[model samples]
Target: MILKYSNFEKSAFLTEKKFFLFYGPNFGKIESCITILKSKLNSLDRTLKFLNLFQDDFLRHSFTEIVNQNDQDDIFGNKTSLIFSLSDLRVSSEIIKLITSQDLNIQNIIFKTGPIQKGLKIRKFFEDSPDCLIVPCYEDSLLEKKEVIMRVFENENIEISLDHKNLLASLLSSERLNLLNELNKLIIYIKTTKKNISNALSILIDNNSHDLNNLVYLLASKKRNDFWNEFLKLQQTFSDEIKFINIFSKHLEKILFVKDKILLGLTPLNAMKSLRPPIFFKEEETFLSQIDLWNFQNLRKAIKELHLCQMSILNNEKSSKSRFLTLITKILDL
Candidate 1:
């Protein structure tokens, strides 16, 4: 019933199971889940068929073609597995109806919905299905953490020791994949240094790891900012450009309204974080704090601006009209 982001695939959904949904923005994650399902069901015959859906040209079927198969027996597992990369729930609903009408006795139907909640209805359908099993693939946490550390370690292998602060800086710049790569690089670095002593290696590793962990807080901030920037972009696309302008207008209005309300005696860092439009004053913080502030009015405005800029880029309309970028630059002084 309840599925974490990582182990959703490994759980039991194969063999006579009713319905299954492999929904998420991570294509890699959904693909991995589908691979596991295929292996479990011994559906090697249809591997090429599944791959065709991903290809541009082969994917010409409507929502009905996915759930309805010519081979009735394969409809259960050999072909019962309905894999959809569509994010539209209404479309998913139509497929579900087709599956019911065809009476495939399907073992599992893998629906890869992007990272959006609009697919909740599709999720609920599986949850409500009597014999169905619902599994959702989300972000993997431990792997992500390991990746962050590995990336920095690869580029800057600390043989002796490293300043905790500078080490943190490198980690901040590194993405999750970069961390794992860096960790392997560190192993190579250690081998080159010929430091066989366990104690020295332990100390070196601990020092770097500690700094990396500390930098996670910084990374968290950047993550929140990045999310905010993205949210603004999405909002602009879905909503009006003026909607963002109004949000920014309202936030500044609120800040001016509540400027004297909050005790300004607090530190700027703390104070800004507490404010309605608190300063995300650093580029590092802006990118790192991508997820911290979401669904906020000010964040909406920021995202809208970003969306506008992206549209401009797509249209090849060059101009200094990126209000979102301008606001971010001004806020962060970058």
Candidate 2:
């Protein structure tokens, strides 16, 4: 029942499953796929109808009652899609089971969520069910972003010089949604405004990013104002709290790697320079500055805090962002 997000057309849409749940941190990819799903629904059968029922409206009727009501809506028994809006509050197995167990007449029952935890009952049901298709949409990694940049850059007919392509890709947002949006704006801005396109685009791309990478350096360097400013932008930019903290932990691990290097008698500057992908040129000074601030004790303590913060999120703690920001403060004091 689990389908790769990229294979939705061949593997998922053509299947006879009645339930489709697209859940993850990749909001843009989820929405883009949904648009394709809806279009396929329309073209696959013109007689088919689409109905949207909100969470409040759904509570008034049982799952069976909802299906039966739609069944009776058209005397000809034309197929219809019943997409129910659900939040974190009502994602119970009992309710999900009510729909999956039935031999329903609905064409599709689509559900969308921000990000479902691994062991959540709702995610478990969808993954286990043959009648359901679950597609997880997470942020693209750097490798994937490189491929995306080429594809999007080519498709958008971007006319930037070859030397700037690598720079543009590196500066791009990791989110597929924001990446495309910013690319479009970049193209338009290029057409109308020629001066400082690269500089303007770099600022736009970095600002658009839900950038844990930048925040880590800021916190480790004890730049309080910049750290919180980026934190505020991150909250508004992306809904996936776990991904945010996960990125934070990863950057800490990077610095920890450098600490290990320093222990081997390599100078801090040389240790940082030895990093494989290399720190951003703009961030090299910041990285060098933080090397002096971090030692084994604080590095271990900060990592321990990150582990606890991740646990808080998995436990469904209220304001996981608070836990994340607290970890930043703890690291600052270290």
CA lDDT, every prediction? 0.47, 0.72
Give me the overall lDDT of model 1.
0.47
**Candidate of highest lDDT:** 2
| Candidate 2: pairs in clash | none
Clash number for candidate 1: 34
lDDT of 2 by residue, 188-274 (tens): 776677645577666665654536567666877888888888777765445445655666677777788988998999988899889
Error of 1 at 237 (Å): 24
The reply for model 2, stretches above 4 Å from the true place, is 59-65, 73-77, 89-91, 101-103, 160-163, 195-199, 202-218, 221-226, 234-330
- Per-model TM against the reference: 0.43, 0.65
lDDT of 2 at 240: 48
Where in model 1 is the C-alpha error above 4 Å?
A: 5-10, 43-59, 73-82, 105-108, 142-144, 147-334
